[model samples]
Target: MQIDPRGPRFAAVLTSAVLAASLITDSGVLLAVQALVFALGAAGRSPYSLLFRAVVRPRLAPPAELEDARPPRFAQCVGLAFALFGLLGHLTGTAWLALAATGLALAAAFLNAAFDYCLGCEFYLLLHRARPRPGT
Candidate 1:
């Protein structure tokens, strides 16, 4: 599926805010909620994207380009993985691990939100390039 290029960036802004809040509050519950968001995003049913379509997109002009959904979905999976690790730390009472993982996720989200850089998307591209071609 194709998506407005801005959609993922919009989601990233929200994700960054949510992640920052979770870090400041040290709230496992909040992190869990973000994790759910990540899970939904990975499944291509992100609530944030729905919100963007229903609410935010209506206010904006048309996008100059669209993008493949696969990369962002892969990025969501990467986010989910980190979120799960953070939750695991919370469950196991490993404060450092929880903070570290959450912090890393926050950094990634912030990069996407503020700079339009997506590390996970880059990783996805890297992996896609490394895969063997049918003719190879």
Candidate 2:
């Protein structure tokens, strides 16, 4: 299966944008933007594909089957958590916490990009292994 790298790239961009925007404007709004972007990705609205085509490389090789599974395993979880944390911070007007979550998200996204070792992919694999296959 082809592992689209666009999600991670968009994540990185969203994180960076939110983080930077947080520094200048309202952190809460930035966090909201990040959350919206993530939600879009999770919806599989073809936004991921568009992002991959627009920003990521065109000649990227296909990914391993195990790596191209679900879109909501680990990375999505982490992203959701981060966005939630940011929302918490936003609600409480806690700039520091929002900044922290955004920073961490950015770091994770970059790591995934550099290593192709998606923490989310690990989560999906773990779930897949734990489950009983059909007719098992």
lDDT of each: 0.97, 0.63
Local accuracy of candidate 1 as per-residue lDDT tens digits, 19-135? 999999999999999999999999999999999999999999999989999999999999999999999999999999999999999999999999999999999999999999998
The C-alpha RMSD in Å for every predicted model, in order, reads 0.6, 3.9
What C-alpha root-mean-square deviation, in Å, does candidate 2 show against the real structure?
3.9
List the candidate 2 regions with Cα displacement exceeding 4 Å: 1-26, 46-48, 54-74, 132-136
Best by lDDT: 1
Give the Cα error of residue 2 in candidate 1, in Å: 0.4
TM per candidate: 0.98, 0.66
Q: What lDDT is reached at residue 89 by model 1?
A: 96
Clashes of each: 0, 2
lDDT of 2 by residue, 9-126 (tens): 5555545555567646755777676677667666554355466666665565553332352644346666768877878877888878876877676666666656655666676778
Off by over 4 Å in 1: none
